[model samples]
Target: MQSWLDVDPTSDFSIYNLPFGVFETRDRAPRAGIAIGDYIVDLAVLAERRLLPLPDHAPHREEDLQRALNRPTLNDFIALSKSVTGAVRLCVQQLLMASSRDAHPPEVWAHALVRQRDARMLMPLRVPNYTDFYSSLHHATNVGAMFRDPKTPLLPNWRHLPVAYHGRASSIVVSGAPIRRPRGQIKRDDDPTPTFGPTLALDFELEMAFVIGKASPLGRPITTSEAEQYIFGLLLFNDWSARDIQKWEYQPLGPFLGKNFASTISPWIVTLEALDPFRVPMPSQEPPPLPYLRASGNQSFDIHLAVDLIAPSGLTLTVCRSNFRHMYWTMSQQLAHHTVNGCNVEVGDLMASGTLSGPTPESYGSMLELTWNGRNPLRLPDGSTRTFLEDGDAVALRGWAERDGMRVGFGEARAQILPALDGEA
Candidate 1:
């Protein structure tokens, strides 16, 4: 996909990927836009200018598309049928294509293009609900062996289903927001009683989350085959953890304050159309899934994921390198299990593939597993080491799907750890 835009050959936002996001100009309200290169093409502006290369038999109305694009979130646009989304994306692609650029008027580029750096990125959608799934077999097993019995690392139901817990959607934030060290109940290994204070074992989990595009009726379950249509696209996710607080609180009920404090996500939501070329066959399930969970075709994406740890002085270390395709359970299986009980999914709902650690120790997703709960520390580039995140430590998560010289990337989800509030009850 050649484009008139001057995009770097290695850039994540290649012409092939017109990933969507919400951005605000200095004086204007937030609007939906697509990443083309170093610039963002405002969909609303394009629609307002009547520049969309819409076909005569387009299924959706131009006015509706304009209204949806003018909104602060992409929910309405994504909620449209796949055909509509595909048509819009195709129109954008054609307009930007270098060969076709000569055919369009100059005003097409003038009104729609905005410098990427000048735009203030906002949350692409209002996430109605969030769920983090323990879908990575290696990540689950590695953590289980460290905390539970090494021999019986996986839980009984892990092999049969995608183990997951409802997450706090309200606390989720877009990338670049500062993360305060959360204060929660922590019981020292040597101490009998638990105390409330700032967590010392703060960590980052590298992950990828998908946004829901289509909504299902309340009591109707979306089958595995039907799940893909409901999915919008993927983004980088960081599930920050309070390991000390979690250790004491997780068994009885599951993650609460330890995880609810913050979860970071990249702004750009790469559409599924951009990722179709990177899809790969999912790993075989030894104990075959139930009828509803079984999926037939290529369901996993070969997205390369990595994490960088930066110290206060700017020393950086690429601590963990992993791949999304390494996960044993596919996204389809996760979504199937999520709605198998008649629970409906809504547009803009976020579902994360929890901690995508690969088959090697070097691919461990979180500090808890990478440092083995502080027994082994990771040495940084400047001789500093990390057991878990410390005050002023910054963590960045990056992901991209690349094949045959084309790339579709989620820029980055980054946050710096700040000191806890002075006083907390």
Candidate 2:
């Protein structure tokens, strides 16, 4: 499909991938926008002019629809149900296609568009809660082999369910936000007592998180087949970690101070409809999951993921490359397991697929794994090496799925490491 707009064939926001996001200009307030090529189609403007298309199931009054689009976050718009959001996506897709150009003149249509460079992207939604799952078999295995017995890399219960922990939602930030290296309790193996200082090992975990669009009843559970319907979209996620703190504190309880500092997500939320073409079968789970977690066929996406390290010298190099399809536990299984205990979820709640590492060393997703927990250091272009992040070192994660010359992707989730606060180091 071709668009009348000047969208390069290589663009992630193709006519087929009309992802939603929030953006604001210096003069305008934050509001919902649809990404297409190099421009953001302001939904508020289209709704104000009655140029926005709505399905019969949507609110009849144009003003009501306009209010939903002009919110500070996409949560309200997402809560409108996929029935409404799905039609809106399809309408926006058609609005861009060359064959279905609207009857309005070019100048009238141009008023609703804004160049991507002129606007600042904001968090697409207010994240009410976050859950990070250890779903990657390879990543878990690597961590186990490094810190635990190499002969038994996996725990006994790992194959039965998705291991996860509640994350700090308030710390989640949009991409481009700088991450301050957190200071916390650090106890080395040789140390007699725990020490409090700036983390010596700061790392980034390449991940993908799905946004929950619908609220569920407190006692009701979401089944595997019903999980995707409740998920509005997906985004690239960087779960920043303070490895030194985690090693000392993570034991009976999962990540706390080590992980609560910050997590970065891409601005755009790529809808599941746009990613339907990239769905693929998940890696087989051994020992098989319980009845509630048994999901059939194509539960994982074939999104290609890459991580790049940007040195202080401005040199950038791709350090890791992996695929989301190799995940042992599918997102459906994660959701099914998450809510099986009657835990209710709401709109804007995020569930992240843990670090997506593949079988090869080059595909390891985190600095801890890529460097074998600091045993091996990665050589950067500046003639420096990194076992973990340094001040001014930035981590950028990119994800996309391309087929038949069409691409659908999360633009990027990037953040630079900042030195710890004064008196804290």
Candidate 3:
């Protein structure tokens, strides 16, 4: 957990922590690098140096490893067993750990690794399928209250198990991509005619998405015991929504256009192993779940998550704050349920935990819930009020786990709204 690199120990990127990512420089194509302070430990160059030692069971050929790194997907790389992952992390740490002055100088650790500013990061993995689950009781209840009576906040089945719907993977974009305003149908209760135009009720859902690295056969259900084996890591996700369109179409089927327009995810996949120390007890269930969804032990992660809204005029507001521990259902349960019907899950499939909201208003995960379905407008620093997102407004999601002198982080997922298309009505 130490590196020879001359990085501040307190920095998010440290030699002890080499989070892998895909990046490209002015002169180089996309390749893998380990974040170390202000620089990226170029894995392609490290491979050329034979500095990367593989675990005994690692897949053969540096070329395969390089190919996996260069490809848009991180699935192949993550499918490598824990032993292989550990070996690579250990070697990278040794190469960057501060060296003894007599043994070697700090500059000795510096190699062809490029500075962060000189490199551009790409999506860490190419997602094959995406599924978003409604796992947060607080968020679900708060949202349900807006449409249903407060006394009957949750649907009968909501407390029994996790509710999820498959989402479009093709529309998932990397952070920094512009989320073009989506167009859809909207009808007010009093309006005689429905209107089709850019969304007026655009918003962001703050949640964590896990990347699947291993596949399960068509008929086999992934047992809770084996769920972690299939998981690679987690990233912050912004499941952007168009509430207006959603309300009109989300009757017999769940969300379609409202939830699928443009979802955003952070670039780095913070490995599950790195987050092991931050594990917490899963929230208690009201009525016990079915046997397939039950785990003998507690399961959850203690990750702090937050969302910020920035106006076009440079004003920023900390909109929401919550923790992952608030989830009513575990990821293992969700995965088990997903495949209970003989559905095959492959590497690169992304599973998102729906808005991780807590109990208080300040912990609301989305503007829709916080504003009570647009009844209460959120006041911004620039003296503007907003019940929903406005064009040109940007939303950013961030998450981290802090404990025992270690900090594991998922970088921000940010997107700005563009004006809706004109003359569609």
Candidate 4:
């Protein structure tokens, strides 16, 4: 996987991992690009110059390839079959590996490559809808134990189907966006009535979301076996939560304003083909799932996930260490469950794995569980204790997969919390 373009060995954007993203350069308009080390190879430029060749194995027409690559968002490109996306990636790999033989001119690299520092990363797709799922058994149990009875942590229906809530697509922002503490109504334990104010318990939920590639009709159901055909790739997701607001509001119905304020995701979408080498067998389901939810292939990715909290005082703590494999429900099952009842899914839609917590206390995903609802405060390196995130606190969610010296990564989903607006309270 060596490339003429020098890629840092430790870089997330290695030659083997050419993840796609959207960026805007100072001189050029916003367009789709692929990461190769510290520079971004503009797909639009390559397509315009006829530099991207269709792989021999794939029979895609050049016109179709050009149309998809030149788009501002990756929605059109990913909306094509997975074979098309794989072909484009293969073509890029071959183009980069052409150093031994002078197949392409030097000017090709000069015109296609853009320094990452000079490019402003934008949301890779226009998300039509977002569904955040409670797929992690450990996370569900931890939250249930903390809030509900410890003896009966998991709900009765939790093991039967993948539980999820339709999220606010408009609030889903890309990495580096500042998240403001949301203002919501809260009823304290001591107070009889609820009052509206900025939330006191702001937290970050470590997660990863899969992007939908293919679109389905309104009444069509996507089976578990057919789910991967609609999936494009994975990205790190941070679903910020207002604990106080959620506790007071969530009752008969699920999350509303409490969980809808903001959600941050990494810029690059790491394709499934790039992660194929790291696939693991899906966790065995107890009380066998319904026929539609049963999967045949290896559906889980062995990606390592970590969360770091950096205080305003410049000290940082790795608050949680978890893995994508900890998810009880696989992406395929989630998608199948989502559409089993005739719900439609469109290209660029996001489905997030809710808080991927593991079996240990150190693996808890959110601040509510990590600090145990302020009863157990985390001691920071700056000699300060934190029950939840403070103003100016920056949280970074990082993830990667390394197997046999090959590494694929989802760059950090990072955001700094800003104080609530003066008049919001």
Worst 10 residues of 4 by lDDT: 97-106
lDDT of 3 by residue, 130-218 (tens): 99999999998888888888889899999887899999999998888989889988887899987888888998998999988788889
For all candidates, the clash counts are 0, 0, 7, 0
Q: What is the C-alpha RMSD of each candidate to the true structure, in Å?
A: 1.2, 1.2, 2.1, 1.6
Error of 3 at 71 (Å): 2.7
Q: lDDT values of the candidates?
A: 0.89, 0.91, 0.82, 0.90
User: How far out, in Å, is residue 92 in model 3?
Assistant: 1.5
- Cα error, residue 87 of model 4, in Å, equals 1.1
Q: Of the pair 1 and 4, which is ahead by TM-score? A: 1
Rank ordering of all candidates by TM-score, starting from the highest: 2, 1, 4, 3
* TM-score of candidate 2 relative to the true fold: 0.98
Query: lDDT-based ranking, best first?
Result: 2, 4, 1, 3
Regions of candidate 3 where Cα sits further than 4 Å from its true position = 8-10, 99-111, 423-425
Q: After superposition, how far is residue 197 of candidate 2 from its true place, in Å?
A: 1.0
In the range 79-103, model 4's lDDT, one tens digit per residue, is 7677778777877877887364377
Answer with 1 or 3, whichever has the higher TM-score: 1
lDDT of 1 by residue, 1-425 (tens): 78888899878899888899999999668998999878998898878877764566666788888888888988988876677777777888888888887886787778689998889999888999999999889988988898889999999999899999999999999998999999989999899899999998999999999999988888788888888988989999999999999988987899988899999999999988999999899999979988999987789988999999989998888999999998888888898889988899999999999999999999999999999999999998667788999999999999888888898888999989999998977
Clashes of 2: 0
* TM accuracy, model 3: 0.94
Candidate 2, residues 1-425: lDDT per residue as tens digits? 88888998878899888999999999889999999989999989877877676787665456667888999899988988898788878877777888867656787677789999999999998998999999899999999899888999999889999999999999999998999989999999998999999999999999999999999989899999999999999999999999999988989887899999999999999999999999987777778788999988888899999999999888998999999887899888898999999999999999999999999999999999999989999997667899999999999999999998889978999988889997854
Question: Which portions of model 1 miss their true places by more than 4 Å?
Answer: 53-59
